[model samples]
Target: MNLRTLILLLIMVAIAALAVLNWPLLATPTTMSLGLTTVQAPLGLIMLALTALMAAMFLAYVLGLHGSVLLEARRHAKEMTAQRELADKAEASRFTELRSFLDVQHSAMLARMDALEARMSNRLKESDNSTAAYVGQLEDQLQRQGGSGSGGVQELRIEPGLRP
Candidate 1:
């Protein structure tokens, strides 16, 4: 089904094929002649069966190893996925909290700006009234000194750093 399983299956098939192909070589008989003795025996089907059995056992062992590895990998992947989900949730929560804090700060800054603007407007109005009153007082003093006939100008000398 999975890649690992497929590979294991393929290996088993190859081993079986090799065993069948080598069957004739394993099943043949041989003779050994020493100087004073001669021995002969039939190996044939017995050797072939043993070789095939060993190959089958080996294939089984490899398949078991592959299955174990696949299981471990699947388990590790699940754990990592869960860890990533938790991290993402934590990051989202932190961002939401920061956004709320910034929103409150923005509102406070706007309110302070509005109050400052109002205070500046009142100060400017007071300054304008004071300037108008001072101008009127100067005109009245000029009229009392002479009705514009006596050159209603007075000059006063001042030292530096003295306020008039």
Candidate 2:
């Protein structure tokens, strides 16, 4: 049981014990003057009964309050649980959207990289062809000039660290 219930039960038990203990005293008669005449009655029993009735009423009130509080707490917990579920769903949707977006971007980047690589390869091939053509043209010119021999065509050469 909860602390509140346990405490209330203890209070009720104490009240019952007190009532039982004072049973003999409650049976005796006493007199009180109510401004006009004095009447004899079992004053202890009446007082005890009244006190017990008040205690019962107070306990009832406490129980009613506790019930109300427990109900409100349960309601609040339910609302929080629903809100948490909603937030989690929203987060999941956001992640899904983000994942899709990233996938699209990744594919686009890969395609662009592939195109760039192809272009670079083509350019390198063209450069190599051009260089080979230039070298072939130089060799053809040299052969033609060498074959025309007009005094064997003395070719002039320049060397590093030498100046004319």
Candidate 3:
């Protein structure tokens, strides 16, 4: 047993022994004042009975206090559990929202990349067409210059003495 319980037990044993040893004295009648009048009664027994009654009341009070403390602790535990669940749900919702936002951004980025590719392809085709036109014009000029001269190679007289 704990020290406090052992000590209380010892004290109770001592009180019981004392009461047993003084039985004759406790049984003997004596004059006692009862507020309005005096009466002959066993004073020792009366005092012992009053002490036992008070001890019983104190025990009941202690039991009630302990029970109330246990109930309060249980209530607090339930409230903490509920709060934790709410926080978890809120965190999950935020993750879902973030995921949707990222998906939308990814889709938009893909669309922009496709648009850029189309524009680049159109520009490349335009560049190729312009390059081909320039080459065709140069061929036509060469053909006209050759047709104006004899069918053989043309001779240019930059100076009568020096031909290049």
Candidate 4:
């Protein structure tokens, strides 16, 4: 039992022991006084009974107070649990939002990289074609200038390594 209950039980035991020890005195008939009245009674037993009644009242009060405190504690615990759940949900939602934002950013960067690679490839092909056209025009001009010599028609062949 709790400390208060234990203490009350101890007190009750002490009172009972005292009553048993004084049973003859407690059983004797005597005149008792109230605030404005007098009555014939067994003084010791009546006093003992009144003390027991007061103890019972005190026990009832302690029980009521303990119950109210327990209820308040349970209510506080429930609020804490609800608050924790809300915080966890909010944290999870933030993580989900961050993940989606990162995904979008990553996709946009990949798209930009692809665009750059396509432009580079197109530029390399354009460079190769222009070089071939320029070489052809020079060869044709040289052939016309030298009319019929053995060295007049020197063909310029572009190797694959030299294409770009």
In the order shown, what is each candidate's alpha-carbon RMSD? 7.5, 6.4, 8.7, 5.4
Across 1-164, the per-residue lDDT of candidate 4 in tens digits comes to: 89977997898798888889989999999987887999998998888888879878987998999999999999999999999999999999999999999999999999999999999999988988888877876677676656766564466544455344
Model 3: per-residue Cα lDDT at residue 115 = 100
The superposed Cα distance between candidate 2 and the true structure at residue 89, in angstroms, equals 0.9
The TM-score that candidate 3 achieves is 0.61
Considering TM-score, which of the candidate structures 1 and 2 is the better prediction for this target? 2
lDDT of 3 by residue, 1-164 (tens): 89988997898788788899999998899999999999999999998888789878988998999999999999999999999999999999999999999999999999999999999999888778676666666566668777787576654322222211
Task: Tell me the TM-score of each prediction against the true structure.
Answer: 0.62, 0.68, 0.61, 0.69
Candidate 4's TM-score: 0.69
TM-score rank order? 4, 2, 1, 3
Report the C-alpha displacement of residue 140, candidate 1, in angstroms.
Answer: 2.6
What C-alpha lDDT, on a 0 to 100 scale, does residue 103 get in candidate 1? 96
Q: Tens digits of per-residue lDDT for model 1 on 89-157?
A: 999999999999999999999999999999999988877867666666666666666665777468533
Query: Model 2, range 1-164, lDDT digits (tens) per residue?
Result: 89988997897798778878988887888896779999898888878778879987997998999999999999999999999999999999999999999999999999999999999999988878776766666677677778887666556442322221
- Where model 1 places Cα greater than 4 Å from the true spot, the runs are 1-44, 146-149, 155-164
Instruction: Write out the backbone clash pairs for model 4.
Output: none
Best-matching candidate per lDDT: 4
Q: Which ranges in model 2 have alpha carbons more than 4 Å from their true place?
A: 1-22, 31-40, 149-164
Q: Global lDDT of each model?
A: 0.77, 0.83, 0.84, 0.85
